[model samples]
Target: MYRQILVHPEDRNLQRILWRTSGDEPVKEFQLNTVTYGLSCAPYLAIQTLHQLASDEEDQFPKGAAVIRRDTYVDDILTGADTLEEARDIREQLTHLCAAAQWIEQR
Candidate 1:
């Protein structure tokens, strides 16, 4: 999720950190220009952003919007279907829906 959502330029200052594995060298300042894994609000914010996107494009992706609103838990998406084809279709729908929402799925 590091590069999925970008950190606003003005807010990048808050995500900065000092790096120095050992005390032998001077510490260096580093800034996170994108959303990273450990931040408290990262997961929630990411999910909420998707939810908002789904809501905004409900007409274009009704099923995807429903899935985003009800089937997701944190970072996991729990969905199923009676047949394998249906399940795969749902998965594909979710994938394309995410792309249509302008979210780049990051592994």
Candidate 2:
């Protein structure tokens, strides 16, 4: 889920990693292009991204947007509806909402 949110280009430098294959090798720098799991800001960034997405697509997915804003926890969503029909509708809305951001939800 974190990997689905891209880091801003200017901020990618802050997520850089240095690695070496062997003791004799020079260190190589790699810039992370997405929100990584272990970074101190990862949780905030991911949740904020979801909020932004909900805001952006609210008109098209009000139910899903509400779920994102109210029920999302880190990478998980815990929500329920009063009726089976409403639950299905919410699921559809959430599926479409996530698809809008290219974030696939695995059942």
Candidate 3:
């Protein structure tokens, strides 16, 4: 289950998501593409959409694994890092980007 949960409540965009899976199964990979519904002006929807595109952010993962990539009406985000440290770094960068209104948070 990869659901985008809004961390801090605010008029502006601020959020984080969790993706979990089970069973020892072969993960299916795909060339991902993202887009916004272009209806609601809420970060929740955008965050959810990102997960919908790619949401396998589990603990046990391969290195340099760039997971989710969501493209809004005119914006986008790329989450999922190779290592824990890389993921944290990505989160920081994403936080700032969202604050700057670049594309909003998709954690």
Candidate 4:
């Protein structure tokens, strides 16, 4: 889930990785293009991104936006509806909302 959110170009520098395969190898620098797990700000950034997406697309996905803002926790979403039809509608809206954010849902 964190991997789905991209780190801004300007902030990517802060998420850099320095690695070496062996002791004789020189360390190489790699900048992360996506949000990484275990980072101090990862949870906040991921959740905030969801909220921002919800706010930005509220008109087109009101139920999804509400779920994002109120039912989402970290990388998980715990929500439900009174009826199967409503549940399906929410699922569809959320699917489209995620698509808009380029977040591919993993089954």
By lDDT, the best candidate is 2
lDDT of 3 by residue, 1-107 (tens): 11232324442232222343655655544321222233354455555544433333323222211333433432354445579998776565445433332234543
The whole-model lDDT of each prediction reads 0.78, 0.89, 0.40, 0.89
Clashing pairs in 3: 17-107, 64-82
Off by over 4 Å in 1: 21-24, 101-107
The number of clashing residue pairs in each candidate reads 0, 0, 2, 0
- For 47-85, candidate 1 gives per-residue lDDT tens digits of 887787778777877777788899997668887789998
Candidate 2: stretches off by over 4 Å: 103-107
* lDDT of model 3, residue 40: 51
lDDT tens readout by residue for model 4, 43-93 = 999899999889988999999999999999987999999999999999999
Encode model 2's per-residue lDDT on 3-104: one tens digit a residue.
888777898988889999999999999999988898788899888988998998899999999999999997799999999999999999999998888643
Clashes in predicted model 4: 0
RMSD of each: 3.7, 4.1, 17.0, 3.9
lDDT of 2 at 33: 91
Worst 10 residues of 1 by lDDT: 98-107
Off by over 4 Å in 3: 1-78, 102-107
Better structure of 1 and 2 per TM-score: 2
**Residue 54, candidate 3: C-alpha displacement in angstroms:** 18
